[model samples]
Target: MYRTILVPLDGSGNANKALDIAAHLARANHARLYLLHVPVITEKNDDSLVTSPSQNDAAMQLIQTALETIDVSDLDTSILVRKGTPAEVIEREAHRLDADAIIMGYKGLGRTSNEKGGSVSAAVNHRAACRVVTVR
Candidate 1:
């Protein structure tokens, strides 16, 4: 039933697993995929400065690497790299793109949660306008 699918990746193994699922679903539903990578910038409470330029560069490289790992030769796909909170950016893009659903990985790199989904996944699932599928 999905037409436009949003896939948020963090360049982690878990995000790649979710990419596989999103790709399959896109193929089955004849849907287009929107790939989003958010380079989060964490700062000290003083908020004196944003993340270093080097950190942003590394995040961009990770996003490019993630793109290389996927084969979108047979699917309609779009890639975006943004700077913000992962969950907020994903949700905003989903609405902006009018995505029918969001497919994302539940596990995260350094965050932990008692729930199966990570903090970002859980937040997006709760705040998104459409359905959210979190792959473990």
Candidate 2:
């Protein structure tokens, strides 16, 4: 029933778990997958800036690793790097892409590696225009 699926990832194992599920669903329904990574804004000594993948290896690796970890080789997949609050960007991309569904990790790397953004997923689940699947 899904034609286009958006999968937002945080480069965490839990996110990859969602990717695995999304990939399987894409294969079954012949759907296209859009992978999105939203980098949290970071601050330097005197300035604050949203990270760009071109300037941040961590952001680039997040995209690369997400691709490497998922088995979407046979499906149409596009990788997107966005800078904003994770929930907002994901919801925007979902609307812009006209996604039929969003599959994401139930928890992801929040402010740090030790915490999770249960709040972010909850927000997306409530706000997204499409169905949202939160994988644990």
Candidate 3:
């Protein structure tokens, strides 16, 4: 029933599960899978920018690793790495991409990682205009 599905990965177990689920849904519905990663910026550069080469590389690698674990040969997929609050970037990308569904991890690498639904996923679940499925 979904035309475009967005799956945000954070290198977490839940995120990996979400990717697997999203892949199945995409294959079933012939939907486009959008993989997004918002890297955790541990330090800022001299220009006070939150983004760095290492951060970008890590984000790309995370997505690549996730993609490799799944069979995406027949899937239309795109990978994106953005710099912003995880929830906000996900929400914005969902809207910008005109996604029909978002399947993401229930928890991420946040202070509330032990919680059932972490802040970013909870926020996206509430803010996304499309259907949101949070995988634990």
Candidate 4:
């Protein structure tokens, strides 16, 4: 029943798996697909991390490579790159695009990952206006 499907990617294997699922679903339903990459931004002087520009470029390149590796001839696809918290950006884009659903990969962060309280998937699941599918 989905017309427009949004798949958020982070250049991870998990996200690539989700992309495959979303692509298959899109083809079956004759739906359009939107690929999104949310660039992770770190604070200034966070020497432990690279700058946002470099990170964004790297993430975009990875996304491009991933898309190239997919057989997307059957589905219409669009690419989006944004800067912000992953969950917030994903939710906003999903709403803005009027997508029927959001398909994303779950990192399967266990207790250790969620010890900080809320995970990105949790936040997006709670805040998204459309249906959210997490492919683990």
Candidate 5:
């Protein structure tokens, strides 16, 4: 029933798995796929610096990389890159895109949850405006 699916990636294996799932779903349902990658931003000393590239620059590169990595030849796909907390950014973008569902990876770096879904996935499942499918 999903017309537009949002898939958040972090360049991790788990995220790639989610991408594959989203791609298949999009192909099956003839839906549009929105790929999002939230850059890893970290504070240095007292200044809040994006550990990744500058916002605009990093976003462009992230979108390019995401497109290159995903197999979207059979489905319509768009890329979005935003800077912020992963869960917050994903939720905001999903709403902004008016997506019908969000498909994302489960585990993340430094995650401690014994459950299949990681912190970000859990957060998105709780806060997103649409249905959240956390691929493990």
Candidate 6:
């Protein structure tokens, strides 16, 4: 039985599908859902990572939109917008939150895979300590 479920959203249709599945799982198990959106940190001319309000806003908006599409009104849910590599942030957050399971899309926005030939979901699946459910 799951007590805490984490779903990483990227505003992609697949990610939204994963959210729906996660919500169902959460409801069935009486679990809490943690929705996470990670905004990529851009590098400036000086090679310094920069985060702007707009970036954060976009992440929040993505989460909000996903929430609006899902029927999780009766479920306990938490939203988080963090700036970092999507895979790393999701992995760390799962550990930090002590999540029992993670449900996410198999592929997200942009490139299908990373430089290592694995997508963000793949990386999280390989590194996470808890159960990983990848929704196609």
- TM-scores for candidates 1 onward, in order: 0.80, 0.85, 0.88, 0.82, 0.78, 0.91
Clash counts per candidate, in order, are: 0, 0, 0, 0, 0, 0
- Could you give candidate 2's per-residue lDDT for residues 16-133 as a string of tens digits? 9999999999999999999888777665434544565453667768878777766688999998878767788899999999999999988887753212534778889988989999
Q: Local distance difference test, per candidate?
A: 0.82, 0.83, 0.86, 0.80, 0.78, 0.88
Candidate 3 has which clashing residue pairs, if any? none
**Residue-level lDDT tens digits of model 1 in 1-136:** 9899999888778888888888888999999998887765677446533666777787778767876787776999887877666787889999999999998888768563324455888989888999999888
Which model scores highest in lDDT?
6
lDDT: which is higher, 1 or 5? 1
What does the lDDT come to for candidate 5? 0.78
Taking the tens digit of each residue's C-alpha lDDT, what string does model 3 give over 1-136? Answer: 8999999998888999999999999999999999999887677677553988888998899888887887787899999998877788899999999999999988876653213455888888878999999888
Clash number for model 3? 0
Candidate 6: regions farther than 4 A off: 44-48, 112-115
lDDT of 3: 0.86
State the weakest 10-residue window (summed lDDT) of model 1. Answer: 109-118
Global lDDT for candidate 4?
Answer: 0.80
Model 4: weakest 10-residue lDDT segment is 107-116
lDDT of 6 by residue, 1-136 (tens): 9999999999999999999999999999999999998877765646655678898888888898988889898999999887667888899999999999999988888564545988888889899999999988
Extract clashing residue pairs from model 6. Answer: none
* Per-residue accuracy of model 5 over 106-125 as CA lDDT, tens digit each: 87543423234558889888
Model 5 ranges with Cα > 4 A deviation: 44-69, 110-118
- Winner on lDDT between 4 and 6 is 6
